[model samples]
Target: MKHLTGPAYVDIRERALRFVRDELIPLEREARLGPEDPWPRDLLRRIWKRSNELGLLKAALPVELGGPGLSTVELCLLKAEIAETGALFALHVLGELSGPPRVGSLMNFASAYQIERFFKPVMEGDKGICFAMTEPHSGSDAASIKTSAVRDGDDLVINGRKHFISGSPFADIAIVICVTDPEAGPKGMTAVLVELDAPGVRMDETYVPMSGQHIDADIVFENVRVPAANVIGGFGNGLRLGMARVNLNRLLHTSWMIGAARKVYRMSLDYARTRMQSGGPIARFQAIQHMLADMATTLFACESMMLHAAMKADQGEDLRMEASACKVFISERCFEIADKAVQIHGNVGVTKNHPVELTFRQLRLARILTGTSEIQRNAVAREILQA
Candidate 1:
């Protein structure tokens, strides 16, 4: 029943799907069947606890770190398979990255102690994380961040604002990026893990990023002091750490987009086969058949690229060029495939009852987040030129 299953990963896919159908799908259906029935916070907590107990929390993480230590390819396969579940459930499947100005930077460069204190807890599935990097002015140019973290004795005092960070509403902690020496530019940057319960941390009430998904608000740090031990990675390593996270996250994202595309493709195919157009099913029509074939072809190519990139990453191969290549291919192809899926659905595709609409909306985020298609192209171009 499982198609395109790979070595070591196929078993994980089967297990994840069983969880998907039995636990995730049922909960999703229950949530949808009711009028305004969001899963209660407690229920979500319980689901996460059960998932963690089931070893789904870190299926790809090393067993010592409380994960399965799956190869990078295995993680990619699992990521794609789990995303097929749904948005609320996917968070439990793929570990969270508290974004820029957050603990992710520390994960790369923190001292062993700093990592144990901040990064390990989340990777171990004990805590949820969010990133505070994007401010009103400092959109994607991470090097130009304005948040200041002034050193004071054993503490670093932070001051600035960040917006559009997801999962902050329920996160136990966050990664905050701040400029330690404004004069030194990006080289003076540092990332600190600021506990949400810490002093001088405030969430602005009105800064809503997205509805339904794990969207949160503006974070204001007014002289919030973090101990020197909390400094993530090396001095000025925030930029590189941020870059690595962005590059690696694309692989995870590749899995999710592929999952969404699969859903869209299935819906499109079903409609094509059953929905009558002229004298027979629309699937018989050349127009619809062409769309279906194109969709399938794109999926194959994109998934192949993703798996190749993942395997390379697992082998400690240089993945920058590959990540950029995969992200560009997956993101652009996803839009084309999703658009075709919607077209096949005709009028009803716009409605909420159809999954394509939601997939369409969510897939759009792929183009912007991590790196834009334009940005990916630029990276690819540079790599090609250097080669």
Candidate 2:
């Protein structure tokens, strides 16, 4: 399923590219960061439905689950392009990180009941889902997670706090990790599919994004009652599930960053070549030329790294370290490209009038969220020593 190839896949990629440029980007521009205007939920539904019509929303799932059910390569292609439009919009449309667990990795480990109860709603686009692993105390160290879920009869009683739970505030279901048997240490942690409406589940607050209105939630579970069937997998398997899901997201993050870098690089390249400065076009200046070169070089590198990880994922190999490396590398370099492009544009780039500034803010968030670069570096270093 991962070894996706053939001409039809390339055609789908092109169609995605066109849809992004022609439909997605234009619609999103109208909803750029604002103070009072919450993104209209109805409008988003319509847009998502349109994406469904285009067979985009299903790019990562199997055909039976109502997705494009594409090969890994096809998933990569759609992800890179859809992500280029803006992640906030992607969240609203793609069902909020629906690619990784909601597709299969999580599903494979989830009990049949968990799959039908949690994953189905997300795939059908009737609900949103988030992976709740990183906590204020744990972050990258999954072993240090403090959340606890105790089994009581047929229910798992959960209690803990999680921070930076991406899209959790708006999500309908939360796939959480909690220590089911703390005596076993990290192995004690378990995955549970707790509905947001569950008795003890509460979204504490939202993490306001840099350039968009997407809500990253801080979730609190106080004796949250999860049914036995809600368990994603067996006890201790939580860490394994968390790691694989993180790698999947890391790979997806790189692809999104590639799209982000490409958008601004191309914009700046065009700006550099045509915009006149001090009697002649600024692009003709040696300094501007260097900036252009830097942006292009970094962009190429980010894209290559993204493709490398995507290829590894297709091979059905462990990409934990590689995905971490890509996340750290692409996250940093992609932001740098956006920053330099903005510098090249001077005053024009700083204004909301230009997309470069918008992209600059967007790329900045990418670095800190989705497993920070610092966390990625720590993971990669550990992998090197083990090897």
Candidate 3:
């Protein structure tokens, strides 16, 4: 649900914009460096701690839970601001502040002891958690994951390898999705809380993709033993619990995409208005104007879809089809906008020095990372044809 009103939201948006403009944007140069650079880590850690002190760390939580708990509408506005800054800032400010993908499920489903031992530390920023679901062979088909968790006396022994696990290298704990009963199909899948430091848990490789600062990992669990009580929402409820939490995850992705799209549009517009061309600025050309206009129009459409879906979610309305539609439309359109932005800047935009270059890489990855556009379309069609 929405926690902030009209003026309050405006204030929050303005504050976020200022933070990105005045504070985060200044670090864009250093943020673009590869993971081998030590400065980015130190800087991100400093900003993360400062963000907590400024009370900007709990944007992912709902209002009832004591965070500003911005509504989906509010998140759209705020994320756009953060996304425009750069990937490092987006990862540190929005990604870190929002907590992990499984935070909501953990809050809703974890037992008292689980809450105190695991959930609380994550919420308080004392630690981080990663959602380990994607496997080497499985991406969108989550139910096909082959990781097995078998009961062994009072403990559950988990064995398998998780690939493309975001935040794994930095996470202290992980919510592992595994097959508990091969005969039960989807119902056989179960969610277990695993401590990364536990014996037999190993993160051997870190994958640094488009954004140099963000790290994904290949995690291996070789007969890793987790307490029987660590099962979230009980055994055999993994898919059900995941479906409940992923709706918000999809919405958050839209917010991040739209935000970055807006940034590129603004940057392109500014460049067109000032860059000298044949007798005048490029902005004077009808072609440039049309491109700018199209970018703005597309961004507005994405925002409308995102806001509408978020509003419906806040009102407790089921938006499965609408959410899928938003995911597909926004992701594709955002990439288009970023591409147009690079064209507008010509050679300079293609350089590693430009923020647009980094933005282009990140937006391109967004299309495939979160349920791919193809998978989202399939989901929309299934819902439509369902009896």
Candidate 4:
């Protein structure tokens, strides 16, 4: 039961598919070249402008804002399809200039002035924002963050070091999570908007992950003063609000993981049919058939779970457990799918000529980012055991 139907949803999906297949997939080679490779920023900007004219860029935003206001299910479906081209394509379609896909959190929690100053500029593509929560020491244990934001007369003087923050290097602003009261533990945390150009804010360097597909940055704040009004959700409410943002992001990750898995499966299936074996194509063999079967089954099950979670979310259900379960299941299964794709393709899978090499590397990070498999399992167990 999807919340959207009729020609409108179908049109959105079809247009998105054509865009990914025709516009984005052609750039796979350039995009996967290396971490130091420059992004197709100008090309992407042109496509973005065209997409906005066609209403594609506005699909994730609310309807009242002159956008399509897609439901969770609709957004997931479109995202999964867009993801077939790759992460960069999916992100571009999701309005990369607006920062992350779930920057809706800012719309909900940011002050009117902050929205006018930051959010609007980001959405309008004049600026970029990065989430600065994962610290040098605080990755999964966000409660363990040591960054401090000392209250002053009309501002908070912040001092901290954040690394592995995506988009930080190119961002003009950052939503930084800091400890406003060390004594209050997680409850003492707060989210503050900081202008990267402000004094004492520095982008130390951009670090590449093992995949070497994207770059994250190390940022240091030394006595950076952010007006007190920039605080989101008020002081002592950061953890709760941050978790809320995580749930939405985890859901998007789950859907895109499925997309990447599906792409791997397709590559494997094509190879199986063409790669010669004993007498004919390997796809005719029972073993190859069984492998494809397993891949399809895994993809179907993961997609089902993703849709279930999305629907639950649309119905206003608390998806703490469902979101974690989806993240854990999809991450592991997507990796397995990619592994199977590699095994099926043998030597070709590892070659840069095919997309699997890049897919394999990116899928591996799916387990670690958003939340680790171990962390998500603990979260699910904790929720189930709670009184």
Candidate 5:
């Protein structure tokens, strides 16, 4: 975490905290009106505008791209702090769950035209974007995506269905990965920028996952013709373009889990200290004390592992193993911490009114979303064996 400390980092971090406390937290109730309700677009736009003015909207991007160009460690630390606020609107404050920054390092590979037409508006808080790669049959196995894009003179006809695409319902465009040359296998795949309003493009259905957020949708492309110029990072390089941001994305997700765990730990601590049980407050019981100690200790370890991986990324080191290991360890441990928080709060923790309940559900999904724990473990095992 030392890598995250510096005068510049401190200034940006404090600003982000102030923005979250002053701007986002107060509106959490309105932003999260219901478990399955869509976020009010007007509210999100206001937050985005304010965050952009504060230089926090694109904080993870490079300076050349209209951002402050914070290092990976600093960006991850900032994300953790925002997530620590435990407000649903925190995701919108930094545009983490969606928009240009969510593309992560992949934006580095964008063509000038693509950046100007697609990326700039999103960065400026005027438009939105979603990464579309998961298909009906493909989840963690990206190579198996069945989405096909065939060349037709200067146009490409795209036909596929992407499910569980985050922000698709509201995004103006989607960075779609499609099979350009079936015979070439993984090398045949390419990433294309497809406007959601294109002909034959359909927002099929919205999904409210276990987290109860209506941020994901199923998108169908039926002969959606896009100019060949929309291709990103050249043809047959979609996998590479997508993998470019995988390491940093994993670390960021881990930061969210760490922050959520911290929030729940505090909630549980306050509950234990005040909730009367047996002959005294729950904090006096060894059972509750043990849970608090475990939560605190594991949180420290999770933060250390996440920051170390983030530092490796900042140093330009390959983080295939480190990121997966960090994701696996932190996600699992923090989820466990959330479970302990629930236990310490007893029946009250599981109720919908309690923040711990939402935190529990959200942290549970972390293990499955950005590569499942089994997938991460397999990645680590493969690396170890090959080495």
Candidate 6:
């Protein structure tokens, strides 16, 4: 984390911590209810408004794009601070999950039309956008996407089904990746912006995953007509465009993992120091001390790896391998830390609504999202073997 520390980073992190503590934690009950029920629109708007007022809403956007233009490391610092609070609304505090920040480096390729119609609204919190790349059959193998978008004179008619789309239920539009020229393989894939309300567009019932977040849904496109102008980053460049921000995204995910791991580690430490057995604290035992020591060391390593990758990204270096390695290592180790925290808490840890319990589920999901641990390993191995 030293590489990420500076006056600006410190200021941003402190503000983020304040925001999480003051604004999000009190709303924990509402956030807990979010998995089973829809978050009130007004409540979401209030959170976004407060975030915007704090100058944190679009902090990840480039300076040229009307944001403070924080570096990748700085942004991760902010993310880690918010996540360390164990607030369920950590993603909402900075609009990381479903707004402009989520668009990430892809904004570099957005056309003027996209900037005006799709991107700006999201930045303003007036609308939301979902990146629809994962299809039912192409979860990890993005190149095998079966969705098709055939050019029909002036429009592309999209026809396919996409499931497990994060933020799809609340998004006003989707950046749908489709196979436009099947014969061209990966080159044929193109990203098309389609309004969610467009004719032939249908959203299935929203579903909550093991992490207990109702942020994903299934979308069905039946000849959904999107104007040719909606194609962003040029035709046949969808894969590259979508991947442009992936390295940074992976690093940010690790930052959140580090934060959660730190939070649970502290919780376990406090519990071990106070939990009494045989007229003594559990911290007196070597086994408990060993677990705490392992958690602390692993957390240090996770932060080091994440910050190293973030610095490489900030330096404009290609981080394909480093990003994958960090994602796999940090996510796995952080999940282990959460497991240890649960063990330390014993009965209270696995109980519903417990912070450590929720962290456990969320960290478990982290390995599968942003490229599964297995897929990330394959990527690292491929890069190594090819080199």
**1-387 per-residue lDDT for model 4 (tens digits):** 444554667888788777767766666555564433545545555655556655677677767654577777877887787787664556666674334353665577777898898877666655667788888887898889998999999999999999788766567788888999999999999989899999999887656776674447788999999899999889998788777668867887787788888988998999998999778999998877888999999998998899989889889888888989999999999999998898899899988736787788888998998889999999899989993
Candidate 3 C-alpha lDDT tens digits along 174-230: 989999999999999999999999999999664667755346778899989999899
lDDT of 2 at 263: 77
Instruction: Give the TM-score comparing model 3 with the true structure, all chains together.
Output: 0.90
Higher-lDDT candidate among 4 and 5? 5
Q: Write the per-residue lDDT of candidate 6 for residues 54-92, one digit (tens) a residue.
A: 877887788776677788788777778778887766778
Work out how many backbone clashes candidate 1 has: 11
Which is the leading candidate under TM-score?
A: 5
Which portions of model 4 show Cα errors greater than 4 Å? 1-6, 25-36, 40-48, 64-66, 96-100
Task: Assess the local accuracy of residue 346 in candidate 3 as a C-alpha lDDT between 0 and 100.
Answer: 94
Check candidate 6 and list the clashing pairs: none
297-327 per-residue lDDT for model 5 (tens digits): 9988988888788778888988989989999
- The better candidate by lDDT, 2 or 6, is 6
Better of 3 and 6 by TM-score: 6
- lDDT of model 1 at position 185: 77
Model 2's alpha-carbon lDDT is: 0.73
Which candidate model has the greater lDDT, 3 or 4? 4
Error of 3 at 200 (Å): 1.9
lDDT of 4: 0.79
Shift in Å, residue 99, candidate 5: 2.3
Worst 10 residues of 3 by lDDT: 33-42
- Model 4, backbone clash pairs (residues 3+ apart or across chains), number: 0
**Clash number for model 6?**
0
